[model samples]
Target: MDLQAAEKRTKELHNLLNKYNYEYHVLDNPSVPDAEYDALLKELVDLEETFPALKTSDSPSQRVGGEILDMFQKVQHHSPMLSLGNAFNEADLRDFDRKVRQAIGDSFSYVCELKIDGLAVSLRYVDGLFELGATRGDGTTGEDITANLRTIRSIPLRLNEQVSIEVRGEAFMPKKSFEALNKAKDENGEEPFANPRNAAAGSLRQLDPRIAASRNLDIFLYAIGDPGETGVRSHSQGLDLLDDLGFKTNKERQRCASIEDVLQYVEGWQEKRPHLPYEIDGIVIKVDSLEQQDELGTTAKSPRWAIAYKFPAEEVVTKLLNIELSVGRTGVLTPTALLEPVKVAGTTVKRASLHNEDLIREKDIKIGDSVVVKKAGDIIPEVVNVLVERRTGEEVDFLMPTHCPECESELVRIEGEVALRCINPKCPAQIREGLIHFVSRNAMNIDGLGERVVSQLFQEKLIEDVADLYKLTYEQLISLERMGEKSVANLLNAINASKSNSLERLLFGLGIRHVGSKAAKTIAMEFGNMDKLANATREDLTAINEIGDKMADSIVAFFEQEEAAELIQELKDSGVNMEYTGARPVAAEESDSVFAGKTIVLTGKLEQLSRNEAKEQIELLGGKITGSVSKKTDIVIAGEDAGSKLTKAEQLGIEIWDEEKLLEELKG
Candidate 1:
C-alpha cells in the first residue's frame, strides 16, 4: 500500500477498534462479539506491522505494558488531584450539608455525581490534543501514564477545543473486563486481581500500554482541572463543558437545589447502583458555584467544598452457623464467620471476616446469632451488625480461644497490634497458611494450586512446606482426587516456573507483618537480594525512606527464625532470583555515582522505559526520584508539562533533562 493509503487505513482501523472498545467497555453495549473485535484487532496489528514506521506510539497496540519494570517513575501533576471528604453515615452527610449551608447560605445548589470505584487520573490537553495523563499520587505528583491513558477510547486523544486544560477522571476496569482478565490470569498460572480497582491500577502501571489497552479500561470525566479561559461559573457548568469537550461524564449527575434533594439522590442510588455497568462507591455532592467552592476550600486530605456521602455497606442478614479460626501465613489468628448462604452484591456470601477478638466483643456476636453481612467496596464480605433482639436465650456467648486453635500454641496480642498471633514458627496452621501464600498467584504465582489442591497435597503427605510444592511429581499430583492428567501437568509446569519470580514478589508472599507489597518492593530494591535483606539490622532498614520502625522490627523478627533461614536456603537452591543483580548502577559502573544524590522529575510520556523502569534507573544510580518537583530535585526529565515541577525546577535552576537524555545517559 502507498504511504497515504496506509496512514488512512491505520486511522480508520484505530477509530473502528476504539468505537467497539467504547461500546463494550464504556457503554456496556457490545455491537460486535468479542471474537469479532479480536479479529479486527489482529488485522490492525498486521497492518501496523506491515507499515511499522506509520504506527504512532499512542496506537492501540501499545497497551499491554512492556517488560516488568523494576520501579515507577515519579511525575508532578499539573494540578493537585485532591481527594473528596467522606460522609460515612446519615449524620455525617447532614453535618456536611450544614457546612455547605453555612458557607453558601442555602442559596447555592449542589451537583451530586456517583463517586466511582476506580483510581483517580488527571489528563492534560495542550492545543486540544491529549498530552499527558497520570495517577493521583500524593495529590501534588503522579506517574506520567499518557501512553496507557490514550488506549482508553472514552478518553479522546485530541479534543475539539484549542485550549490547554487538565481534566480529572476515574480510570476503571469494567466489571466484564475484570472478570475476563481474572479468568485469563487464572488460566495462565498468574494471580488474579482482587477487584476491578486493582485490575485497573495494575493494568495502567504496566510499562507497555498494550497491556492496559487489552484490559478494556473505561473512564468518566468528573472535574475540569484548568477552568482557565473557559468561562464556567458553576461545577454543573464544568460538567457541561467536559461533556461538550467530548469527555464521558457520568449520566447519574444531578443538580439538587436543596440538601433534601441531595439526600434523595443518594438514597435512590443505594439500590440503583448495582444496575450500572461500573462500580459506584458513593455519591459526591459538590457546591456547584465555582466561587463558593473557593470560599469553602479544603482540609489536608480532602476538599471541604465537596463531600462524599458513602452508602452504608450493602447488608443482608445471615445466620452465623459457625465461628472458625484460621492461622495465616504470618501466624496471625483470623476468625471466619461461616454464615448461612445469602446473596450480597451479585455474589453469594457463605462466609465473612469476623476481624479479631475485639470485633467479636464489640459486636457481642455469638454462635447462632443472625448477623448482617455485606461486601465492602463490592469485594470482601464482613459482618456488620448482630441481631441481638432476634437472639434466643439458648444462643451462646462465644469466647475466642486464647490459644492457637489449630496447634494449641498460646496466643499473644502484641502492643498496638489488633491480631492475636500464634508466634510459633513451626505451628502446623501457620505453615499451611504460609505454604498457601507462597504458592499464591501474587507471590510465587504457582498455577493450578488452589486451597483445595494444597489441602489435598498436605493430606496425602505429598507436601509439607511451600518448598515441598516444588518437589511434587506429576504422578503424585495426578493421584490426588479429581486431579486429571492435564491438570496435574499444568500444575507442575506452574510450580516449576515460580522458581524465578522477582525478589519483591517472594518477599511479600512471606507474609511478614507490616510488610505489604510496596514495602516488599522497597526492601527488595534496597537490599538487592534475600541474603543481604535477611541480615540487615533494624537501623539499616529504617534508614530507607518509607520503611517505618514497625516494619523494620517485623523484618528483624521474621529473619531471626530458623524456619526463615531454612526457607531461604531452600528457595536459593530451587533457583529463585535470590540476588540483587538487577537493581544497581544503570550504566554498568562506567558512570560516576554523582547521580546518586541528584533526583530527577519525569514529565510526560517516554517511548523508552515505563514509569516503574525510570524510577528503578534513578534509584540504581544511587539517586532518588521523588514524586513532586522540589528545590531538591537535581534535574527534571521534563516530558510535556512537567507541571509545577518544571516551573519550580526553572525557578530553582535545577538541571532539566528529557526522556531521550536520560536514556542516553543510561546507555553511556
Candidate 2:
C-alpha cells in the first residue's frame, strides 16, 4: 500500500483494535471473534512494516512488544506516591474512622477499593497519549518502565479525552496467567514463581518487553497524582472520571457512607475473595472528599485520609522437620525451623524463623512436631504456635549450639540480648554475611555481586573481607561458577563503581552494631568524612540529632577496633572514596537567608513547584520542612486550597507565606 493509504488504514486499525481491546479486557465483552480481530491486526502490522512512519506510539501493534532496554532509568515522580497506614482488624478500622471523623466531622464518607496483590505503578499521559510508566520506588523516585507497561492490554494507549494527566495504579498478574507462567517455567526446568504478586513484579521489571507482554498482566487505575488539576472534588468521582477517560478501574469498589458499611464490605469480600480471578491482599479505604483529605493532612510517611485494611493471613499446620542455625552479619546466631513443605498464604512454606533460643524455650517448640504456620502480612512465614496435641512422643527437643557453626568459636549471650552471638571478628560466617550486606542494594549497591556470587567468592577463598572486594581481579571473578567473560567484566565495573559512592553507603555497609541506613547517613553528614568519624568520640556523636547514646557508643567502639583501622587503611590504599559527597545540611546559625533556622510546614498543592522540589530548595536554604503544622512552626507555606494546616497556623498566630512569596524568598 502507498504511504498515505497506509497512514489512513493505520489510524482506522488503531481505533478498531483499541475499541476491541477495551471491550474484551476492560468491559469483558468482545464484539468480534478472535480470528477476525487477528486478521485485521495482521493487516495493520503488514501496512506498518511497509510504511514504518505509520506505526505511531498509540497504535495497537506497539502492545506486542518493544526493543530490549539495557537498564531502567530513574524518573522523579510528579507527586510523591505516599503509602497508606494499615488496619489489620475491625478495631483498627474503627480507630481510623474515629480519627477521620474527629478531623473532618461525621458527614464525610469513604471509597473502598480492593488492594490488588501487585506492584504499585504511576502512569503519565500527555495530551491523551501514553507517555510514561514507572514503578513506585521510594515514593519520590521510580524506575521508568513505559515499555513494559505498554504491553498490558488493559492499559489504554490513548485516553478518550485529549488531556494531560498522571494516574496511580496497581499492576497485577491474574491467578490463571500466573499459574500458566509458572507451569511453563516448571516444564522448562526453571524455578517457578512463588505467587502472583511476585510474578507480576518480575514480569513488569523485565528488560525485554516481550516477556512482560507474554505474562498477560492487567492494571486498575485507582488514584490521580493531582486531583485538583482534574477538578474532582471526591475520590469516587475521580475514579469515575478515570473510567470515562477509558482507564480500567476495579468495578468492585464501593462507596461507604459509614464505617459500618465499610466493615460490611470488608467482611463480605473476605468470604468471596477466593472466587476472584485476581489476588487481593486487602481493601483500601480512602476519605471520599478531596477537600476533606487536605483538611485531615498527612504524616511523614502516609496520608491521614486513607488506610488499608489488610486481610487476615492464611494459616496452615505443618510438621517441623528440623531446626537450622545461621549467623548474621552482626554475628548474632538465629535459628530457623525447617518445615515439611506446605502451602500457606498462596506460597509453599519450607521454613520459619524461630527468632531466638528464648522464644523456642518459651514456646516449647520441638522438631518433628506439628506447628501452626502463617504468613505475617502474607509475606513472611512464621510459626504461629505449636500444635502440641498432635505432636508425637517421637518429636525431639532442639538445643542451641554453644559454638559458632562455621568458625567453631565459643558463643556468648550479650547482656540484655536473648540471641547467642559469636564475638570473634574473623568468624567465617560473619565475614560472609557482612560481605553480602556490604554489596546490598541500600549499601554499596554493587549490581552484579548478588548473594549467590558473594557466597561463591567466599567459598573459593578469593576474598576475606569487605576491603578485599576492591582488590578483586577480572581473572579471579571469571574463574568462579556461572561467571562468564561479560559477567565478570560487569561485576568488576560494578565493584569499582561502588568505591565512588558517598560515605553513607560505606558506613551502612560496615555492619556497625546500632547504626541503620538513616543513622549512617546522618552520622556521615555530621562528620563529613570517614577519618573524622573514626576519630570522633561518643560525646561528639551523641551531640548530633537522632544519634542516641547507644549508637554513639557503638560508633566509637567500631572505630576503635584494630581490625577496623587496618580495613580503613586498606580501603584507602585501594583508592576508595571516604568522604561524604551528598548535599551538606547548612547550620541555622551560619546561614543568612530568611528561611534559615525556621521550621516550615507546606500545605496544599503548589502550581510552581512540586512538593519534593519545594522541600529540597527550602532545605538547601537552611529551612527544616516538617509534615504537620504545630506551634513550633516558624512559617507555613500555604498554596491553593490550603486546609487544616493553614487554619492551625492561623489559630496559633504563626507567620504564613504564599507560594509567590516563598518563590521570591528562594530566589533571593
Candidate 3:
C-alpha cells in the first residue's frame, strides 16, 4: 500500500481496536470477536513497523510495550491524592454523617463507592490523549508508570472529550487474574503473591511493561483530579463525566440520600464482597456536593468530606492441633500453628504464622486449645488470641524448639533479634531456602526453577548451591520425574537468562543477613561491581548514607567468607554478569540543584506531585530522601493532609515548604 493509504488504514485500525478494547475491557461487552481484534491489531502492528515514524505514543500498538525502561522517572500529580479517614462501625458512619450535616446543612447527599483493595494511580490526559500515568506515592509525587498503565486496556488511550484533565483510580487484578497468576507461580515453583492487591502492585512495578501487560490489570476511575475543570459539582456527576469520557468508573457506586442508605449499602456489600471479581476492603462515603466538600474541608491526613467505612476483619475460632517449626534462608526458626480447618475471610484457615516464640508465649497458645484466627491485613493468616477462658485442661503448653527442625543445629538468638537462629551454614534447610531466594522474582528471576524444582534438584543431589544450577546437564534434568523435553528446555533457557542479571540482583539473591534489595542496589551502584564491593572495608561501607553498622558488617562478613569468595568465582566462571547495569541515582556531587545536599521529608497529600515525584525531583536537585522527619531534616515539604511529620518538623524548627512553594522553587 502507499504511504498515505497506510496512514489512513492505521488510523482506522487504531480507532477500531480501541473501541473494541473499551467494549471488552471497560464496558465488558465485546462487539467484535477475538479473531477480529487480533487481525486488526496485527495489521496495525505491521503498518507501524513499516512506517516507524508514523507510530505515536498513544497508538494501540504501544499497548504491547515499546521499550524496556532502565528505571521509572517520577511524575507529579496535578492534584494531591488524599487518603480518606476510616469508619469502622455504624457509630463512626453516623458521626461522619452528623458532622457533614452540621457543616453543610441538610441539603446534601453522598456517593458511596467500593474502596477497591488495590494500588491508587492518577491518569493525566492532554487534548483527550493519554499523556502521563503515576502511582499515588505519598499522595503527592508518584513514579511515572505511563508505559505500564497503557497496557491496562480499560484505561483509554484517548478520551472521547478533547479536554486536558487528570483522574484518580484504583488499578486492580480481578480474582481470575489473581488465581491464574498464583497458579502459574505455583506451577513454576515460585512463591504465590498473598493477595490480588499485592499481585497488581507487583505487576505494575515491573521495569518491563510487557510483564505488566501479561498480568491482566484493570482500573476503576472514581474521581477527577480537578472536579471544577470538568464542571462537575457533585461526586456522582464526576463519575458520570469519567464514564462519558471513555473511562471505566465503578458502576457499584450509589447515591446515598441518608446515613441509613449508606449503612445499607455497606452492609449489603459486606456479605457479597467475596462473590465480586475484585477485592474491596471497604466502601468510600463522600459528601455529594463539591461545595459541601469544600466547606467540610480536610483533616491532617484525610478528607473530612469523605470517609472509608472499612469492613471488620473476619475472625474464626479454630483448634490449634500442633505447632510446627521451619528454618528460613537466614537460619531463623519460624514457628507455625497447625490449626483445625476453619473458614475466615472466605478462605480455609489451616495454619498461621506464629511470628516468633515470644508472640507464641505472649498469646499463651497451647495445642488442642481453641484460638481465634484471622487474616491480618486480609492476607496473612495469624493467631489473633488464645481463648484462654474456654481452654480445656487437656490442652498442652507448646514448647519452642532448641534446635533447627531440619538439621538439629543448635538454635541461638542474635544480639538484637527475637527469633532463634541456626549458625550452622551447612544446614540443609537453609541451603534449600537460599537456593529458592536466589531464583525468586525480585532476585535473579529464574523462571521455571521454582521452590519445587529447586527442592527436587537438591534432594536428587543434582544441585547443592546456586552455582551448581549452571552445571546441570540437559540429560540430568530430562531424567527427573514429570520433566518433559519441553519443560527441561524452558528451565535451561530461564537459567541461562538469569546469568545476565545485574549486580544488585546477585547481591540480594546471595541472601546476605542484613543486605536487602534496596541496600544491595545502593551498594551495587556505589561500588559498580562485585570485586569493588567485596574489597570494601566496613567503615567504607558504613560511610554511604542509608547503610548502617549492621548492613555494613553483614556485607563485610559475607565477602570475608572463603566459601563466598569461591561462590563468586564459580558464578563468574559460569558467565554471570557481576557489574551494576541498572540506572544509578543522581548523587549530590553530580547535581547543583537548590535541593542539593539537603535532607528532605515529604508529608501529607500533595496536590501537584506524588510523594515519589517530589522525591525524584528533590533527588534530581541533589537532595536526599528520608522517610520520616528528624533533627537531620533540612526541609519538610508539606502538602494537603500533612500529618505528624509536619508537626514534628514544626517542633524541630525545620524549614517547611508547602506544595505551592516547592512547585515555585522547582520552576525557578
> Residues 522-584, candidate 3, lDDT per residue (tens digit)?
889889999999999999997786677767888899899999999999999999999999855
lDDT of 2 by residue, 1-668 (tens): 67777788888888899999887788654556555788788899899888887878888888978899999999999999999999999999999999888888889889999999999999999999999999999999999999999999999999999999999999999887886675444323244566798999999999999889888899999999999999989999999999999998986788899999999999978866775678999999999999999999899999999999999877999899999999877677888999999998677889897767877898899988999998753556888889889866999999898999989999987665566888898898989999999999989999988999999999999999988899999888877778999998898889889889999999999988767787898888888899999999888987676676767888888888898999999999998999999786576678899988888888877999988789988888888887556556889999987765787799899999999999999999
Candidate 1, residues 270-301, lDDT tens digits: the string is 86666455787799998888888888887888
| lDDT of every model, 2 decimals | 0.77, 0.87, 0.86
- Find the number of clashing residue pairs for candidate 2: 0
Residue-level lDDT for 157 in candidate 2? 93
Clash counts for all predictions: 19, 0, 15
Which of 1 and 2 is the better model by TM-score?
Answer: 2
RMSD of 1: 19.8
Sort the candidates on lDDT, descending order.
2, 3, 1
How many backbone collisions does model 1 have? 19
Which segments of candidate 3 are over 4 A away from where they belong?
316-320, 323-337, 340-372, 375-668
Q: On a 0 to 1 TM-score scale, where does candidate 3 land against the true structure?
A: 0.55
